[model samples]
Each structure stands twice: as structure tokens, then as C-alpha cells.
Target: MEETYLSAYVFKYGLEKALKKTGNIEEVTSRMIRDVSGGVRVEDDISPEGLIWIDGDNFNTWLKPKIGQCQADGSFKTVYQAAEHVAPDPYSIYPSSGKCTADGLVGADGKVRKNVI
Candidate 1:
């Protein structure tokens, strides 16, 4: 597959917070869903270093708490609590060239301390 470079911003508070603050989540999510479904091509645009232009829907999904109050009091504290389903899998992904590191996977959002190269 051809490589795609997305503008990235892996924030400590989480990308969803940034998206909500920017008021771009709805627009970004729409575009991302289309792209992931192969219905549209993702656009190349300028994004802040800590912010990445990727599948918004996937990122949104990744940010949600998997366990919620039902499973645990504060399961939402970390992404790993729901890594199996919450983390971005097929969308909002990193460059295929990035390697696995102690941080889990370099360049992958919400996984490492240094998310971008």
C-alpha cells in the first residue's frame, strides 16, 4: 500500500480533548470515516505538531473509556484499560516504517511518550 503521511498531535491529555477544543472533531470524524471505509481519500493539510490529520472516527473511538463506571471506577484513566478495542487500529495510524519501541510502538498515537518522529 502507498504510504500516507498525516499531520500528528499526540497530546498527553488525549487527542479527543484537543479535537473538542478545536471544534474540528465532527468534520474530521466524517472525513476519517469515509477514508477508512475507502469511500473517500484523506486530504493532506497543515496540522500542528501535536495534532495529526487522521481518521477522526477512529481517534474518537480510541478515546472512549472501555470499562466506564460499570467496569471500574476510573478505567478511563489510561488507554490500556481498553487497548483491545479502544486504541486506533486501522485508522489514524502511524507511518508503516515506524518501529516498535519500549513505548509500545513509535509514531502510534496514544501509545507512546513520543508519538511522532
Candidate 2:
């Protein structure tokens, strides 16, 4: 797998509140669902950091009460939540040498590549 990078943001309030204010949850949800299947690819060396939103269907519902500020009364202070099924980042899950992207994978030599998945 290739080494991908995604910048995460942490706000004073919980993820739910922050998303509601910024109105970025919808965009995130759409990208996660359509591109990464509601999850981000990771490996032993690579790990997702920060609060990830799970059970996010156009902000219809959130899986865990504490997403970002995982404290008392919806305080997402904790970075990681066990029950959250949300993805950390955007589309990723392809061989590093293939140069995979949102559209598909690309071979290093630029040949013999057509990812079905």
C-alpha cells in the first residue's frame, strides 16, 4: 500500500457541533461513502489519527455520542472512539507502485492496469 496523507481538524466542540456549524459533514460523508466505502485504508506502519465520524448519512445520524470530544455530555476530547465506524480520510486502498487514485490505479510503467474494484 502507498503512504497516503490526510489532514484532520479538531475543534473546541464535538464533531457533530463542528460539522453543523461548518456544514462540512455532508461533503465528508459523500466522499467517504462514494470513494472509500466509509473507511480509510491503513497498515501496520500507517494509522489514522484524529476523530472519525461514523454512521454519518448526510448527518442523519451519528454512530457514537463522542466523536471528537469524547468526554462527558458530547465532549469529543478523545481522539479515537471504539464504536465509531466512520472513515478517517478519503479514498485510499491501492498498491503504492500502481499510483492509484480516486479514479483508478496507474501502473509504474504506465501499462497493464485496469482495477475492477
Candidate 3:
């Protein structure tokens, strides 16, 4: 089965809340992973693949909302590390910020119109 992962930030709040309510962090995290993965799509910004195109600005604005964190510093630490933590998976927690070293999509003309980075 393909592995899946989520941004720690995205699951942090929900995990904390579930822990408070049920005192079961592992179960909560498992359920969250399942819920997030279900019905996911490529166009969805949080999808694992889509994350590749996410820039620091977009990560702070979009991904942070689902996780309830404030905008990250320009250094891009939070998002990049989070993505790396969950690798080889079709999960959304991956980093998409411009600071990442991965290459992005190219246009039909063979020019790399990849994400900023």
C-alpha cells in the first residue's frame, strides 16, 4: 500500500484536541491521516504532489490555516522540514515552499516554469 503522511502542524491541533478529549494521541493521528487522505486530489493544494508547487507564501497562508499556525518566517524552516519528515508518501504534509530544492513542472515549450525557489 502507498504510504501517506501529513504536516505535523496540520495534525498538531487536532491531535492535541483529541488527546484532551480522549487521551489517545496515536488513535487521533491515525484517524486524522485517514480522513485527510480520503477524497484527496492532485489539484487540492494539500495533496502530496500539489505541495511541490507551494511556495513559502502559499504554505503560510493556505497550509497553515488547516493546521492553525501563524505565518512562518521567510527562512522557510517549518514547512520544508515538515515535508521532509513525511517522504515517499502520497501525503499533503510535504513542503511546497520556494525554499525547497526540488524541481517543479515545465511548460510544453521545455522551459521550466517551476515554483519559485
> Relative to the true structure, how large is the alpha-carbon lDDT of every model?
0.35, 0.39, 0.36
lDDT of 3 at 57: 21
For candidate 2, which ten residues in a row score worst on lDDT? 1-10
Query: What is the clash count for each candidate, in the order shown?
Result: 6, 9, 3
> By summed lDDT, which 10 consecutive residues of candidate 1 come out lowest?
1-10
Runs of candidate 2 exceeding 4 Å displacement: 1-69, 78-97, 101-103
List model 3 lDDT by residue over 1-117, tens digit each: 102344443444345555666666555666654333322222344454343222222222223122323455632223333333222221234333212222333344555455433
Candidate 2 residues 1-117, lDDT tens each? Answer: 112242122121234444554578755453333433222222224334433332222222122333464567863476755665433222235455465344444567776467545
Top-down lDDT ranking: 2, 3, 1
Candidate 2 pairs with clashing backbones? 54-86, 68-76, 69-75, 69-76, 69-77, 70-75, 70-76, 70-77, 71-75
- After superposing candidate 1, which stretches have Cα over 4 Å from the reference? 1-33, 36-60, 71-86, 90-117
> Roughly what TM-score does model 2 have, to 2 decimal places?
0.23
The TM-scores, one per candidate, come to 0.15, 0.23, 0.22
Better of 1 and 2 by TM-score: 2
Tens-digit per-residue lDDT, 1-117, candidate 1: 112223122232234554555568655454333334311223324321122233344333222233324346633332234333234464225456354432244443544444444
Largest TM-score belongs to which candidate?
A: 2
Q: Residue 114 in model 2: shift from native, Å? A: 2.2
